[model samples]
Target: MIKRITAGLLAGTLVLALAACTATVPISPTDSSGLGSETIHVGIAYDSAGRGDLSFNDAAGAGLDRAKKELLVQATEATTEAENDQARAETLRGLAQGGSNPVIAVGFLYATAVGTVGKEFPDTLFAIIDDDSVSADNVVSLLFSEEQGSYLVGVAAARATRTNRVGFVGGVDVALIHKFEAGYTAGVRSVNPGITVDVRYLSKPPDFSGFGAPDKGTAAARQLISNGADVIYAAAGGSGSGVFEAVAAAPAKVWAIGVDSDQYASAPEAVKPHILTSMLKRVDNGVFQEIQAFAKGDREGGSKRYDLKVDGVGYATSNTALNRYKDDMEKARYRILSGAVKVPSK
Candidate 1:
């Protein structure tokens, strides 16, 4: 249905808009004439909290950095603003028009924007991460079993909590965040149905600032902590920093479970001691694999799933507590991968 819009007309409208100022980070050098050459020019449009978030965007940035160094590819990166549909659309169009092939949009928010822009540049390949809504032939959807990974961390939270009460903090109250909450709650219940689970979302849609606001995360985490939650799992983006900060400042021994990347390695050293484990979503692997596929003259379209069975989703084992619970987590991982245990993604 997105194809109903005239591609030529949309392209014309975006030509002048490309010069508008926006928050962007250039990852690599530019090569204008490398359209069909061996050189792969990647353009990434990141979600809120851009690079250095040490969470989701940073994971994607790691992949691009690897491709630039090892694959010798050129890349340009742009970031989107909070709840700005026009900015998201213009950013994607700007990347395509700038001669970057296989431009990647790095969040579910880019679904509608990518669908609209990919049509204008039929020759340019486009990919979207965490979104499967766009079904264009030129669009490659990079999906992850985030629920599966969240489930693992939930188990860790339930097992490590001294007080049988754990909490969950989400960046936004959307269907995607719901998947994290559902899987986490299910995993916690699977461990001990009697365990109390408290859940809270930072903000609703259209107020995406929740993903970037550490102070808001701190407030939410404190409330959960006061309510007797000894362990907290945060699926918030950069806002997870607030959760970690709160845990670090708590007088009691509070533990935190991070999402997306390994918070133990990515988080600040002061907060590292408070992080019990992390839910590994493997956004870096997905980005690298898609770019590698494009470079091999392969146009892999449709919804590509990254799940636990393929090492796409898993848990970080950097914390010392993992030594005690390694066997249990491994067994849980096997059961889920084998389909013996079904994790809800609601």
Candidate 2:
């Protein structure tokens, strides 16, 4: 009886969503070309840092690419402005109504917007990365165990520091950002408990530009360095690039740990070697999986959390970049996964 009711409900939802297809935004030339016979249109709204950050946005886009090539999906990018979290959500809704197959929203900025849109289009398979939780039945929220990966980064920053003082510049002060900060601080303390960590955000409570702006991010990093932070962890996005620039110009013993993707190669040559490691948030993989599930009729909505156990998030030390620290990073990774160490989160 339960299986029969479930089948009926799903069939009914698909019917309703198809009726509302007229409400979605129109497909553009960029999204139309290269679309094959088996293609499914996917909308990816990126963070303010934009596509070439060589970081978070690029990684998420890779996942969409995987879905496109493997499953013949079509991808379109929707860029967001600084502090315009709500507007981004509306944009996601527009893409869905426009007949996009499975829309993926990157970052925690889309959480609330996804929640609202999920309710409006019950049959739309929406995938939101970086954060989770959905009130609707058809929305799949892809969240990472960022805390676990952050702990490894914290250790890297501490170990790389010459002054024994480190800094953390966060994108925002929300719970999700806080998770990064808290886990990082705890990880550093585990390596050297007395090391002081100076924490700062780009904005206060609601605004989220601490991750977007390079100028402000550079200024904050400079201040921390001036105050004796020899190493820093940048959970801020484009803002983090600023920290890299500041470190390059600074005279002190300075280095930075980048977040989201493999940033060693993305950084300028001046500070390229100074890159300790990167916190890899597998945003793209998560999105690709959800879209594939939809294509195979296995899409499940609501909140979803992917952790180190699932390779959702972790820190990476590339042999091409940080050969010296590769072993240390591996040790940290093993410790976290083995449960010998527990990383704290907010």
Candidate 3:
């Protein structure tokens, strides 16, 4: 049975801690034969943004930290430099070769790498986040209903907007981000059929630098703000920081919605007030549960989905600004949970 991992506040500053570093740093290995060892060494290969993205990567790191503290597991982490399949494969392969069992690839971009490396190390179990296309006996896919959470945040944005216009900024124009856009747009429209929703993507596929480019995120937000959008939701990973900056600098009051984590807690002091809410994807829970399962000797592999039914995806309400709309959002949440409202994932 799939278990629910409780979401908690991350302990640390929210700044992009490793925004520039991009090299593989291997940790000392433990017993390679995970079967008979008292301690298990875990390995994680993050996407280009790495540990300090303050969004996706940070969530994953939180889980790793919890495992170390509670499960007593040793772990080594690496970030992809070139963001290509070759670099990702090498990172996974290196970790497996170093005796790190149950190596994890943090983003869907590592799908090809996971498939390639999982075959090479059949004895070592593997997990990949955000993607489940890989078919392997030793690999488990950790998937999430990102669209469901995005829909909740979209409702929040629609309710908070003063101009009756909202905006969406995506890091890349990929199918994954598309799910975010689809649900968010639907949520906004559900509140008001005539609301104007501005959508922009920082970069398209093949040039995924948008995920790490704050400058681009700022530019996108500015454009939306100029178009009279008072509430903006950013699913642009690290670029979401730029969206918050733009909203904070806007002449009139505006709100920015964050993705993946409780960005209000991590945001700078000045920007915190402007953040309405964030779509909580609960990647930390996924990471922590996977490690916990492996530690308990559950090696079965396949696709495991985290959806609204499992409390895997939802909206954060840290800011008091969201308190006023709590009932509305909660009603929407009930509809989603009851399957009365089927959130689109396209």
Candidate 4:
């Protein structure tokens, strides 16, 4: 069950903060492409760092962009910098009230907010990413098998590491991020039971600033590197940038693995060579599919899982450095897909 936000916590200060921090972008509606005559107005409520994070939020934005072009839908987006539930609830309410159907909330943090605002607007459809706790007829949960993808990256890291040591830097110490850690550790140990795997989280729950803070990511990566970790995987959202920076600056050749999007493609030239690969979460595909389903007149709400078999989650190959591990990664992928390997999500 989803936890309900306390009614008394909706303070005036939160309202003011929401107003000051929320920025909504409105896209002009165009003719619906073959779906129907009705213009589908989609709205997205992003987590912290919003569109420019070049990681999670950008992946969602890519889906919105596809909807705009392929589906010919008008879109509006609002981002919430505040960590509290009140601000997130208001952002969703604003979008739904403005006639945006199938409002997409970019992160699992919006679960409670979606539950609250979803009740108020029964007619409006709400799609939330990374969470499946909201039990509402009007809500659709977009989830991914992050562990499956993380496992593949872990295999790559273990195989590429010369020091037989690797590290994982998570943004927050939450169950969601724990899945990444669990799968990574299992993958490392699977390759070599004696391999040392260092793990660190930037922040804990109720203080999600870790996802947006690059400095903490740098500190964590530096600490792991000092301990002789040659390959590090960062599931730290915007903080992953710092991890890349830290790896690139190391005196010895070190590899960095990114999460969510293809970090190697977006990384700077100096950092590109250091990025081994990224665990592609395919959030963009989830978002696009949700909107596409609604546009096709399927309004039923339920949980949709994007896993390896569906090509929903996997690792990137943009960096040629991953060539040596291609055969091994493919074998691992086949095993996971064929049910020969069970990746843990804890």
Residue 26 of model 3 has an lDDT of 35
Winner by TM-score: 4
lDDT of 3 by residue, 162-214 (tens): 89999999999999999999999888888888889899999988999989999
Q: Which residues of candidate 1, in runs, are more than 4 Å off?
A: 1-37
Model 2: colliding residue pairs: 24-97, 24-98, 202-210
lDDT tens per residue, model 1, 1-346: 0112234523433222121122223333363322234556778888867887888898898888777765667777777654566767877877777677888888998888888888899888899998888877898888888898888778777788889999999999999888888888888888899999998889997778788999999999999999999999999999999999999999899999998889998777899999999888898999888887787677756878999977888889888877787777788888897899999999
Against the reference, the lDDT scores of all candidates come to: 0.81, 0.73, 0.85, 0.86
In terms of lDDT, which candidate is stronger, 1 or 4? 4
**Residue-pair clash count for candidate 3:** 0
Query: For each candidate, what TM-score against the reference?
Result: 0.89, 0.83, 0.89, 0.91
In what order do the candidates fall by lDDT, top score first? Answer: 4, 3, 1, 2
Q: Which ten residues in a row have the lowest lDDT in candidate 1?
A: 14-23
Candidate 2 lDDT tens digits, 146-199: 888888788777777778789999877778878899889988888899899999
| Candidate 4, position 161, lDDT | 91
lDDT of 4 at 88: 92
Better of 2 and 3 by TM-score: 3
**How far off is residue 225 in model 4, in Å?**
0.4
RMSD to true structure for each model, in Å? 6.9, 9.3, 8.4, 6.0
Candidate 3 accuracy as TM-score: 0.89
